[model samples]
Target chain A: MKLLLRLKFLGTDFCGWQYQPNARTVQGTLTAAAREVFGTDCRITGCSRTDSGVHANDFAATLELPFADCPIPCARIPAAFAMRLPPDVSVTAASPVADDFHPRYTVLTKEYVYQILVSPVPDPFLYGRVWHYPKKLLPDAAARMNAVAAELVGRQDFASFMAAGSKITDTVRTVSDCRVQREGDLIILTIAADGFLYNMVRIIAGTLLLAGAGKLDRVGMRRIIDAKDRAAAGATAPPEGLYLNRVTYHE
Target chain B: MKLLLRLKFLGTDFCGWQYQPNARTVQGTLTAAAREVFGTDCRITGCSRTDSGVHANDFAATLELPFADCPIPCARIPAAFAMRLPPDVSVTAASPVADDFHPRYTVLTKEYVYQILVSPVPDPFLYGRVWHYPKKLLPDAAARMNAVAAELVGRQDFASFMAAGSKITDTVRTVSDCRVQREGDLIILTIAADGFLYNMVRIIAGTLLLAGAGKLDRVGMRRIIDAKDRAAAGATAPPEGLYLNRVTYHE
Candidate 1:
């Protein structure tokens, strides 16, 4: 019996969310916890392989645990696993999913938020969680960027905004939503898509940031998108500022 | 001439806030940054020797620099220092105070907060920042804790709540305000006082936690306060959840 669990984590101390061999990964930790609790690690998979230093408010993973004749105290599993886990890792919830249910192959969109701290002083409290770009972004940059993002809301070739040598053949992912908002010292970049290519988000965010920072104007943005070449886009933004905000799935 | 600067830091990456004879302390980091910018080994002094894993929002500190011959770029000292310093430590503000202004002695009041996360599953993002007390608190614990905190307000002999083995002759400190508020799943305990003895805030927070958890009754709180004995108090809370929120100076 496999269980699909929703999770949230701070990925600073992790080597991203994947199960690297002999590495301290979020999935590896979860695997170990599951092994300890259920006494096996046959089936476990993550919804996404978040890059190093990335954060997540809602990440998911599937694990196979025999609910039939569970010998251990199943109710105390979360608390028990929590005791053995470090402060940086936490299990939000666990539930039994259909045997065919998959965390990654689910039919829905993923929402990510790229945080930028635009202020004279870097927020000490939000150091790692946000990109400390204290240099004031250009006025009307948010609106202009939103307009550019609107162009990407539908299915389109996102090859220009993806890292080179991406094995994924399809660059026609539908960007369901792309909105930018400013709150005090923060510039939040919310992007939703059916799927993402390698470094697609970081690259797209970089292009948008260039526009927001006034380095690349709206014309440049249009040129980059139409070029359909990875080299035409701006530098890839840092991974620390990116967050896996949520992953939606239908029943 | 010297320049005194008040600051704050997340102590997770630091050994502690004070400078040790041979250690990577917050003071050491600040002093190094100050030297890198001011070109002088400024003797930085912190208000408290915050324990390892402790956090401070407005940790008071004084930086002794040769302000007389300060470089033309000295006005950009905070930004320069921040760049040289690590992400966890920040020079929030820089101002020239009196030469005799000692961060520890000249401070009039300090406010601190201890957070508790009462939920079934821990929040991975708030792991290093908040204490996870997944145990269900008493139903009316919030209101009950507030009422008890109000009683402890004003000038009172806080000997009972203060941690043991202190040499301070006076244990009477005016607790201006102590509040318990819940925002989402996190519970924050905020306290302000003219001065605090060793582990005073932690001990008080621990006892209040007891009240919130229903481990100790309201009468027990008064008894502990009136007892005026350190042994009468609950366990001292962990350092991770405690934050030196701010420091106030006397006229």
Candidate 2:
């Protein structure tokens, strides 16, 4: 049976989502747990390939079992997996899917959130969950960041935001929403799109950070987007502050 | 000179606030950093003693140096100490205080927050930060918890909530406020009081959790308090969900 799984993980101690021989990765951990629970090997496919230290609030994946049926009920799959999984990773939900359903190809929109801690002194509670900006942000930093983020909406070739040395030729993507907001000492940038390139969201977050620091304006953002050069954009933001928030599927 | 320091720490890896010979503790970690920054042995006093795995958002402490003067400015003390402190402990603010000022004897209120995650599935992002209740709470859990919490606001002999082995005879404390609020899947209980007994807040939180699950009501809460016996109250909640939120000193 083909099963759809919704998972969440704190990626601080993980190498990434993909399996590596010697390193500890989310895929490897889940695969081992699946092997323990099912008593056989299984194929696991993730919807997104996250970088190291990139968290996920709602990640989608598909699992193909060797048997025709699962002995455990669909609702109890998460509990069954919990016994073999570490505390840092959890399977929130699991259900049967179509035999041919693909976790990645059937997605509609993917949303990501980048968290920035704007404070002179770091917060110990948020040690590994945010990017600590030691310098004080400007008074209107969120407004400035939002102004620049609005310009990237709609379908566009986001070549400037993509990381360098990417082999993929296609850079055109549809950005449905982008927003920046502040709550207390934390500034959050949320972006949703049909798809993302290598380090695209991180680069966009870095550009927004520049805007928040009063170093970049709307005109500067537009110029960078039009240049279509990775060097024209800001530096790539750190992976710790990034989270894949949600993945929506078509009805 | 005596310096008042405001601090924050994630206590998941520490053995509480008091200094221990071999155990890793918040006070021991801060004392080492203080000695490194001040270049001599100094006396450190904390406002309250927290248990292991209890966090602090705004803890108060006082540092008394051996010398009469400090070369580094008061505003820069936090930065100076940051170099020696770990990422899980931070000194947020430092300021000059009267030589006779005491962190524990200050005449003001102390606020604490207890976080409860009400969900069937645990959240990996909130690991070691909240008490995960794996059962579904009543729909009006917050309102029900608040109704019982309001009964705790007043000067009363809270012997039922105090730990059984506490040596202190004075269990009477003035509670300024007690509130329960819900934000999404998190149910937060905030309480302010002149002082707290050993395990007072944890016991109260456990009793409130019973109320949230529809097992206890306002009448039950009143009965427990009036009993004035430690066994009359619910079990003490785990320390991970408790936080020292704030300490307000008299001007």
Candidate 3:
């Protein structure tokens, strides 16, 4: 039987979400824990590969239990598996799924939130959770970023925002929502898209920051998208401030 | 010259805010860091002692520089000292104060905030920062807690809320403000007082939680205070949920 699992992880100690041979990775840790619970024959597949230090509020995965009728109940799987997992990672929920269901290939939209802490002095409590950008965001930064973000919606080739060395050739994607807002001392940028290229969200965050910093304007943003070159876009923001917020599947 | 310093610490490590012979303590760490910045002869005194795992957002301390004329400017002290301190402990600000000013004495009021995350499952991001209470609070828990908190204000002998092993005999303290509020999934309790007995805030928090859980009532709260016995009040809450939010003094 196939099991769908929802995960939440801090990502501070792991290399990333994917499995690596030797390095400590989130998939590696979870796979190890699953092995201890259901033996070494269980097959696991993650929805996406997040960069090192990228957090996830809601991540999805699929697990293939080898036994015809596993003894562990679906409701109790998360709690039972959590005992073997480290504190940084936890399987929050689990459910049985169609035998052929795929977490990533399924059609739906994904949402991401990037956090920036605007402060003159460092905040000790939020040291690693946010990008502590000491520079003050322009008074009209949010408005300007929102204006530019609106231009990026709809179907388009997002090649400029893709990181270098990506093997995927199909760069066309659809961004359903892109907006920026300020909540107290934090600047939160949220984006929802059908699919994302490698480091697309990070590059979009960097580009929004540039507009906020007065380096990019609405026209400039449009021109960068049309350029279709990675160098045309702004730098990629750090992975620490990024979070995979939600993943929606077509019902 | 006497220097006043503002501090913020995570409090995940260290024994507490006081110096112990061989234990890892906040004062001991800060003292060692000061020695690196201002030599071994400098004297450092913290404003108050916090139990192990209690955080501080605005803790105060007094430092007596050994040299009659210290070379480091007051503005540069925070930066200089921060280099020698760990990421968890930061000297956020420093200033020259009156020669006779004291951190513990001559205080007008102090405020503390305690955080409790009311959720069945633990939040990985807030593991050590808040108390995870799995039970669902009563529908009128906030109002009930507020009622009990109101009874705690005013000048009174708070022997019922004091810890058992405290040496100080004076139990009279004045609570200026005591309130509770809920923000999202967190229930925050804020208390301001002219003075606090040993574990007073923790005990108050415990009693408030009991009231919220329907285990204690308004009459029970008054009765506990009138009893003037440490055992009359509810058990002390864990130190991790408490934070020294602010300390004030007469101008």
What C-alpha lDDT do the candidate models reach, one value each?
0.80, 0.92, 0.87
Cα displacement (angstroms), candidate 3, residue A185, comes to 3.1
User: Candidate 1's error at A3, in angstroms?
Assistant: 0.7
Query: Which regions of candidate 1 are displaced past 4 Å?
Result: A66-76, A119-124, A139-144, A217-219, B67-69, B72-75
* Candidate 3: residue A131 lDDT (0-100): 82
Between candidates 1 and 3, the TM-score winner: 1
A227 in model 1: Cα distance from truth in Å? 2.2
Candidate with the larger DockQ of 1 and 3: 1
TM-score of chain B of each: 0.93, 0.98, 0.96
Residue B145 miss distance in model 1 (angstroms): 1.7
lDDT by residue (tens digit), candidate 2, B1-251 = 89999999999999999999999999999999998998888799999999999999999999998767777898888888877899999999998889999999994999999999987677888888999887788999999999999999999999999999999999999999999999999999999999999999999999999998899999999999999999999989999899999999998
Pairwise DockQ winner, candidates 1 and 2:
2
Question: Of models 1 and 3, which has the larger lDDT?
Answer: 3
Q: How many backbone collisions does model 2 have?
A: 0
Q: Which candidate is the best by TM-score?
A: 2
lDDT of 2 by residue, A113-203 (tens): 9999988777888887898888877999999999999999999999999889999899999999999999999999999999999999999
Interface RMSD, candidates in the order listed:
1.8, 1.3, 2.2
Top-lDDT candidate index: 2
